[model samples]
Target: MDALWEGFQEAVRLIVRGDAGLREVAWRTIVVSGSATLLAMAAGVPTGYGLARGRFPGRTLVLSAVNTGMGMPPVVVGLIVWLFLVRSGPLGDLELIYTKRAMVVAQFLIAVPLVIGFTAAAVQALPAELPDLLAALGAGRLRTLWLLAREAQLGILAAVMAGFGGVISEVGASMTVGGNIQGDTRVLTTAIVTETSRGENANAMALGIVLLVMAFAVNLLLTAVQQRRRR
Candidate 1:
């Protein structure tokens, strides 16, 4: 109880004072997670649309794999990324291990499956005759995709929320691949973990508060957009 209250106070102080390190961690959290979310959306949205519409062979197997990936452990994702990027690994010649780039990659892998799953579900929910109607109305592939996407913006925004939320809040993969180096790869989630590891419970909680606020703020913006679209 006392610890939580102390953490609340510390959180207020950190925010009011605009602590440099805290700000840095917060900003990096946004950059890395935001980048990952955007990349996931870019890659996953189209693929999901295809899955929902296409009739190619092995599609069921692919969707099943994506569904499995949606629930895969973040730490395992981190370990896989680490293995691929680590020195002496196949792609290690690029030397991206233990960097912000690596963190972004890990988070992207963590978020993409969720994006795909959500997008597929959302796209599949639309009227089955809608595609044929659009095609009959002379909408080409890209144009049809755009129109369908606008119609399904709500789910896409939901995917945005889920993707950003997933990456921003995940500590395991970020710490594992990012190495949590101060001023470089350290993000809010990893910072909280660092504080807790050293027994700084109050600071950990304070950082958690900051993380929640950040996530809430981003979600609020997306929700506002979603609701406006709904109206």
Candidate 2:
């Protein structure tokens, strides 16, 4: 109890003092996770729409893969990415391992599946005839997608939340691919882990608090937008 109280106080002090290291970690976390989530949404939304509306060979298999990916272990994804980016591995010539970009790639992989799965489910949940109805009214494919997306905006927003939440809180892939290097790829999650491992419980707790607050702030903003659209 005393430890928890102390940690909470420390967190408050850290925030009040405008700690540069804390700010750096927090900002990097947002950059990596936010970029990954945005990219995932951009690709996943269209892929999901196609899966929901188009009849094609192996569509079931692809959907199944996306579903499987949603539940895939973050460490496993990190390992796969590391293998590809590591020296002597295929594509190793790019030399991207142990960098912020590598972390983003790993995080992107983690977020993409969630985005795709949620998006597919959202698009699928709409009335099956919605697409045809729009087509009959002479709407082009892009316009029809826009309308369906608007109609299913709630689910799409949820997808964004899920994708962002998944990657922002994850530590394994970030550490593995980013090397948790100071002033480079270090983020809140990895920093918290490092602090904890060093027995700096107060510092660890402070970082954790910062991470939670950051996640909450971003989600709150997204939620406001979502609810506004609902209105």
- For candidate 1, the clash count comes to 0
TM-score of each: 0.98, 0.97
The Cα RMSD of model 1 versus the native structure comes to 0.8
Candidate 1 lDDT tens digits, 1-231: 988999999999999999998999999999999999999999999988889889999999999999999888899999999999999888899899999999999999999999998999999999999989999999998898999999989998998898898899998999899999998999999999899999999999999999999999999999999999999
Predictions in order: lDDT: 0.93, 0.91
**lDDT, candidate 2, 115-210, per-residue tens:** 888888999999999989999999998898899999888888888999999999999999988999999999999999999999999999888888
Indicate the residue-level lDDT of 221 in model 2: 92
Least accurate 10 contiguous residues by lDDT in model 1: 156-165
